[model samples]
Target: MELTAALRGQTIQNRVREVGINPNHWYPVAWAHQLPPGRVIPVVVWQQSIAVYRDTAGQVHAIEDACPHKGVELHLGEVHGDRLVCPYHGWEFDRSGQCVHIPYFPPDQKLPCATALSYPAQERYGIIWVFPGDPQLADSRPILEVPEYDDHNCLMIPITGVFNAHFSICNENTMDVFHGFLHKDLQGWFDPVLLNLQDSNSSVQANYRVSYKGTLSKFLGLSTNSDGVTTRNVSVHYQYPHYHSTMEGVSSLYLMRLPVGPNQTRSFSLLFLPKVRLPKWLLRAIKPVLVPLVLRFIFMPFLEQDVGMMESEQRTYQKDAKRRYVEVNPAIIALQRLILRQYEQFMQQSSQSNPANPASQPPFESWQDQSSNSSIEPLTVPHSGKGQ
Candidate 1:
């Protein structure tokens, strides 16, 4: 549904900070290159530990991180052909997580019914993705698309972010363009006005007009006149587990979030800038130097500032979960509602599939009713004299 473009103060709910992710979607676990053939690494999605490894044949697989025999971490084990060998007892498991060999087993004896839960794993866009929910649904749910990944006209920069905050907090930081005030010293955009806002069961789309200035503005193709002030529209799309934001054809950012636990989140982002377009040969020559330089001198500073604020928010929220805060951005509210709804939907499905599982109950029943009212007003930033 469409939402109004008016900013208004509303009581913020603490329940958003406590919600868990709907594991039915695909999540990026690690860069494909980071996990070499015959290597194993441990990854967590929504608190579920997984051991991901690439077989010698170059196929990726994900299984429960713990060995079913002795509860040892599988990541510490070795990769033998297509199976992962547990270090503790030399128990070997195949890609399907079925125990195929035990060092001490007799030839005539049948193997025990031991198995580790296996997840659907795949490699795409230079990232390893895993589906932590029903394996049948993995084929239907699609990964986030990045059209600029293979485009020659766009310069792609891979950015990784580790934030010591809840995924909700980190996600809100992306939707809250009003926080540009925090980056004013870096000549970030100002005089923001929400132009459009839309919300659905699975996504939230927000568009805002913002003014830019300074050398950074010029480098990003955000300004044209010598007066150094240029206004552009910024659109942010939150498609549940991931985000895509663009600035009037100047730049595009696709942020893939990994929720490690309730207190930590990691992001795998690919930033594309049209201004940095260059011949493929020249781009390859300077990419090593250029990617780091832009990331360090340009993006990292803004990221550091955002990290500090997000972590601080997490700390305060932890200290007093009941503490109330006023929020003026309607986009933020829509994001929270989507998060809650996804979790509830997952819990409801889990209950329907297995009614006897007590764990399938929604974490907090109070929050279920919270998703009823989904209307939200748009965010509006106060105008500065220079921009107006």
Candidate 2:
């Protein structure tokens, strides 16, 4: 549904910060290059720990991190041929997570009915993706597309962000373009006006008209002159588990969010910018050096500032879980609603599938019954003109 672009104060729900991920989507666990052939690495999606490894033949597989026998971490073990070997007692598990052999067992003896849970995994766009939810749903849900991954004319910089904050907080940072005030020293865009906003069962899209000036703006093709202001439209789209944002033809960002747990989140982002006015061949030849330079000198500074604010928000939220806050951006409210709704949907489906056990649903009491008479005192945005 389309939402009004007008900024209006709305009560913030603490439940948005308390909700968990749906886990029905594919999440990027690690960079594809991190696990070369014959190597294994440990990764976590939500709270589930997984061991991801590449077989000698170059196929990626993901299985429960714990060995079924003695409960040892499978990542500490080695890969033998296409199977993962348990460090303790040399138990061998195939890609299907079935225990096929025990080193000391007799050749004619039947193996125990031991099997570790395995997850659907694949490699794409230099990312190792794992499906942590219902395996049956894996085939239906496709990974987010990134056309720029194969575009040679764009200088693609892979950025890794480790934030000590909830996925919701990290996501809000991406959708809140007004926070550009935080990067003003870096010549980030300012004078923002929300142009469009849309929300769906699983996504939130927001567009803003923002102005920029200074040398950084000229270097990024945003302005013709260093001293002149340039206005551009920036669009941010949050499609459940991932994000894709773009600024006209200047840049594109595809962020794959990994919610490790309630208190931590990681992002695997591919930032693509138009290559400098140089030969494609020359750009390709110098990409090895150029990518890191841009990542360090240009991106990291901005990321560091974002991380600081995100972590601070988390820390403050932690101190007072029920502290009410006011949010002016309708886009942020839409995003929060989507987050809460997705989690509720996932839990409801899980409850239906296993009615006896019944997954616990989030307590959205205050959020569901929000009104002016609520007891929680709402904190308004500070008027100090400081970057919040």
Candidate 3:
């Protein structure tokens, strides 16, 4: 649905900071190259710990981190051919998590029926993805499409971000274009005005008109004249578990989020820039030097600043859960609503699937009652300036 792009004060929903992710979607765990054949690594989706391993055949498999027999972490085990061998008892499990062999078992006796819970796993776009929810939905729910992954013309730079904040806080930081002032010294965009906003049950898209100037702007092809200001539209799309944002036609960023827990979030992002027109051979030759230079000089500074702000916000929220804060961005408000809705929907589906399971009940149920009202009293900030 379409939303007004008015910057009006709205009471922030504190529950958004505590909500859990709807796990039906595919989540990125590790870089494809990081988990080579015969390597096992542990990854967490939301709060569910998973053990992902690549077999000798180069196929990836994801199983519950805990071994069913003794509850030892499966990631600590070894990979032997197509089976994952538990460290403690030497129990061997296949890709489907079925216990196929137990070294200590006698040849005459049949092996006991034991299996570790397994998840659907795949490798795409140089990243390893796992389906942490219902296996039935894995094929239907697709990973985010990245056309630039194989496009030789675009310079693809992979970035990793580990934030000490909730996924909601980290997500809002990306959707917020008005915070450009934080990176002003770094020649970031300025004078950001929300141009349009749209939201749905699982997505939020915000467009903003932002002005850029200085040498960094020229380097990014944002402006031909370094000293003169150039205005452009930045479109940010928050599609459930991931994000895709574009700076007109100059660049595109696909940020895939992994909600590790309530207090931590990880992002695997691929940034594509169209400024370089060099041949594939030359581009590949200079990629090693160029990737680090761009990351250090252009991206890391902005990410560091964002991380500081997000962590600070989380700390403040943790200190006083009921503390009220006012938000001026309507897009942020919409994002909060969408997040809540997705979590609630997931809870509802889970409850219906297993009605007897009390653990399936939604967390922060009181927030649903309070948020039903269209508006709440806005809290006033002391400074009322750019920093707020």
Best-fitting candidate, scored by lDDT: 1
Task: Give per-model TM-scores.
Answer: 0.94, 0.93, 0.93
User: In lDDT terms, how accurate is model 1?
Assistant: 0.88
RMSD of 3: 3.3
List, residue by residue over 128-234, the lDDT tens digit for candidate 1.
99999889999999999999898866777898999999999999999998888888888778888888899999999999988888888877765567776898999
lDDT per residue as tens, model 2, 340-375: 888888887887899897654344443462442333
Against the true structure, whose TM-score is highest? Answer: 1
Of 1 and 2, the candidate ahead on lDDT is 1
Clashing residue pairs in candidate 2, if any? none
Q: For candidate 3, lDDT tens digit of each residue in 1-388?
A: 9987767777888889988989899999999999999999999988899999999999999999998899999999999998999999999999999999999889788988889999999999999999988899999998999998988778899999999999999999999988887887778877788889998878999999887777777778765444487888999999998999999878999999999999999999999997765677898899989989999988999999999999999999999999998888888999998888888888878888888883432376734523323354422223223321
User: Looking at model 1, how many pairs of residues clash?
Assistant: 0
* Decoy 3 TM-score against native: 0.93
For model 3, name the residue pairs that clash: none
Global lDDT for candidate 2?
0.87
* lDDT sort, best first: 1, 3, 2
